[model samples]
Target: MRFAPLSLLISLSLLSFSAVSQDTNTVTAIENDITLKQADFDSFTEILNKHLKDESQQQHQLDLLRARSTKLEKEKNQALDAMNALYRRLIEDPSLDISDTKLRYQNAVDSHKTNKEDIAMQLASISAHRKDIEKIRIDRHALLNTLEGLKEQKNTARVERLRNEFNRDGTLEIQNTINCKRTETLAACEQRGQHLGMQKATKRFLDQVFANLTEIRLVEPKRNSAGARVQVLNSHVVNSGFSGHGNYDVNLSVTMRGDANNSRLCHLLNLDNRFCSEYSSSFQSIYSPQQSSNFTGNVRFSDPVTVSTTYPEIEKKSQTYNKPVVNILNEPEIDYTHELTLRSNVHDDEVFIDGVSYGSTRLSVQLPVGIHDIEIRKLGYNTFKKIINLSKAQTLKARLVKNKSHLVSKPIVETQISNISVPGMVVIPAGSFEMGDITGNGLANEQPVTKKILSDSFDMNAKEVSVSQYNSFAVETNYVTEAESGKGCAYYLNGEPVWEPSLNWKNPGYEQEDDFPVVCLTYNDAKAYADWLSSTTNNEFRLPNEVEWEYAARAGTTTDYSWSNDIGSNQANCGWCGSEWSNKSSSPVGSFSANQFGLYDMVGNVWEWTQKTAGQSDVAVRGGAWNFAPSLARASTRLILSTDFRANYIGFRLVKER
Candidate 1:
């Protein structure tokens, strides 16, 4: 038999050579076989070397492909991570719209997954290529051995048959090569497509997230039923009977006035159907309630005043015709009983005295022989008692000075009243109290005492800002107080008081007096005064809020009067209030007396202004005035007025905060 190529024969022998032996006659055959095997071995070695080189190149290509796939996978994972981070950030930012970002990010994530899947799928393709290449290498090795072995065998027929078979196998190998090449090319294309998609998705996600950074909104003001913004300026003081008048302007901060569908004023003024500015004239000033003072005096008859009887000699007779009789009866001849002097203890400066029904520095009365008991009382001052035994003709002298210390001024102490030349200023402390009122109490508004806490301490005037005080402020600041203007106020001239139309702070009837409270002022004017005081004295001065006013007035006592509930005696200086006002006009601050808070003229004088304004209405006023009742003077009472109108009963005070 023709032996296979020596290389193949040796390779097969290695497998079973241990079972066979080498010897002599075999030596001759072995020598020839050795020579032929040597030739075949050389040829086999040459072909196998070429095949190995080709297989090595194919393996190197596969290795390069695997490395590229690995790199793509790493890139895909990184891109996916970036996309996820962007999505997370977009979701967390409150201002950002993450829908577009999410869409792009999801696409990016999907693309990365697709890339990985593609790579994985390509792995199978690569594996197939590897297997095909390996198969090709095996086939080439076998064919080469067959070709080499046949030449050595020197059998022409076997050579031709092996060559034909080898050629047919080689042709089949070409098909395998073509398959591997096609698979590798398709895998590469798929990989490139996935990578491109991933990159685009990543870029899109980033761009979307970056664009989601800017978003904001502004809200507009809503309109009321009146289509106008009715603002309450603040509480103001007005006389007891006068109607309060004030102006309110709408705020056009959020919407333009021209753009509004309709504009009107609402509240006590009730101008909702009309333009707000039109009513400005009506509210130019408010008139406070009118108050009337009652008068009482000691009836006295003395020789100094009786001289008029001696001069009365002229008599009138009847003019008649025939029988006219003249019967002129002379005054009855009687003894002129001496006029006795009566007296009371009370100061007549400008204070409202209680129980006397008259205001006088000294009260005097003539009485028959009897024992008389006399008592002295002032609005805010304590009473003085006196029991005297009197003869038929006796003269007595007595003094009535204010008695303090009987009232508790805890929330507002009397010591805080600075003698500073500033007009009508008082100080208030920081505290909590109920404001407003309910029905059970006398005043309609004093019943519901809403609890309020004040964070800062402040000061207020002991009484309303008197005309005298306002004049001083105007002089110093070159500014006008509302009362000073002749717009709508009563002015005290030389020794008489009159309502003037053109009299103002700039042209006052009598501006030199500094004891009266500033009056006829608007809310803006009060604010200006507060500002000026702060700037000039380095102190914070302002208006008293409703809560502070009640707290200060009550002064720890929840009673009608600071001294007592009975309004007959220990009340305040007011006209027709409790019995009478001694027939007088506005009394000075602290003239009637101070409340438990050491606040003077809190009631029965002029209504004091507060910082609070009526909601949806004109400005409000507090404390009762001279013409008001004792019930109205309760700390919880509330009165309202227009901003532009002024009256004789209205007044205000100043405040400072520490």
Candidate 2:
């Protein structure tokens, strides 16, 4: 959104063309092309953090104010108690120091005034602190946004030179498979990334995605009956592994014992899988019941790393069938050849049809009803080629004639295809839960509880949307909030809701971190942001319906509060809680532990807007805010406000439709 002057390091790196070496120039040139410039990026982060508006300082000041308010209230109460006691003594004695008693009473009244003045000044300072923090946050976002422009700079001369070098380099893409061996940690391997694929040789599951990829980095390259060596020839980082930690591409290769068909592809620390030991791995592997010369395989990946949508669970039909024998009573006259399958006795062998390599030994391909040429080859083995006429769905077994004389190695290749599930969303598995307030102690609106079923699973952001996230949306859309243009957000002033022009998501009438949920957004404002997000990400994101919101908030608990029935202090932000933030404003989301569903701030921080419309013009808001009493902060508590209403205590979370 905003540009910052280039840092001294960046400026120096850009200038002094004659003094800078060609290699230095080359590094600077490609820095624009890479996603990470480790050193420069790290330096920039340090600078940003150093200058970051520390909202916590303001929060600390607010805490002190609350403590001061409590202490003053106690002193005032004590003085009044002393005055009352003295008056009682004098009445009993029928003669006493009435002057002293009167003085005590007057002093108590004066103490009350002083307390009020002190608290007012404290509140004012807290507000100023909030303003300061927001400004710092604005600067922080603007600085971070500038990184894209900085990284997008291009030098035509350097780019051309780099391209020329890439063309001249013969060892760019190593077709052979490689393993990481014992080096599991990226740091341990000097940050060398082994472009891993399934190394499992057994064609247990033949899916086209895996079939198309040259190297299959298996879940367990060593455990598929023939624990082969997890071997990496060399770790290649454009230059070499030793120097390859930065943002650049590299090439590598690998091999192991046993038929490659039996192994699932994976990267090892360049150790022969046979020589390396097995460790805890992830994801299920597709197993082929029968190993055929023609392999039918399916593709799958280890978990934590997401599988791409392009590679759907389409099971490539590479099944091997015994040639049908003529049966007059049961068998059809002729099996029309429509689907064709080809396999190799050896794994990772190149299979070619019409001169184009299918990329692996065992492959399934659809052929028109006609004759075709198939070729299968592996290095150190004889090349296999054959011509076959197809009349029906037929499976062809290509026994590669061993190239006992050829010294060529097998090469497998597949094209590369590129969440929040962002970093914080958690998948709430599809399940039916009885919806509504189980405890009847809640509001009448939570009445008429019903048993509802969620037909489909959905994802919910673990934490409420933060200020930084909302800022990005606002910047991209050039959007303004209802509060900014309307009556402004309703904030507490002298113990009453008052519209303040300074009150906004950026200020939120309190000091808060970027991690704090953004507030003062109306229902329409929230919806507009949701629509923009859906258009941008092509994912259905919306405010949760009241029913879904309560279900997630309850997280399978029937308690009044998300944690349990008893109104516990420090569990949420509310007026009744004598916590540090009590009767002040929202805290950062997840300040307290999350509920059973791993959702943070489900019951407090702010009353989240739900999709449920109330009456004729209002929108439903749930989970009370910092200013509300604990009773209203319960999961079952329901409050509705006009569609135009925006307050420092109103915000919303996200639910992605699945």
Q: Residues 78-99, candidate 2: write the lDDT tens digits.
A: 7778878887887889677778
List the global CA lDDT of all models.
0.42, 0.52
Candidate 1, residues 192-287: lDDT per residue as tens digits?
A: 222222122222222222222111011111112111111111111110110122111111000000111111111212221111211221121111
lDDT of 2 at 252: 25
RMSD of each: 57.8, 26.0
- Using all chains and alpha carbons, the TM-scores for the candidates as numbered come to 0.36, 0.36
Model 1 alpha-carbon drift over 4 Å, by segment = 1-420, 423-444, 451-457, 481-487, 490-500, 503-513, 569-571, 578-584, 613-617
Please state the error at residue 346 of candidate 1 in Å. 16
| Cα-lDDT of candidate 2 | 0.52
Candidate achieving the largest TM-score: 2
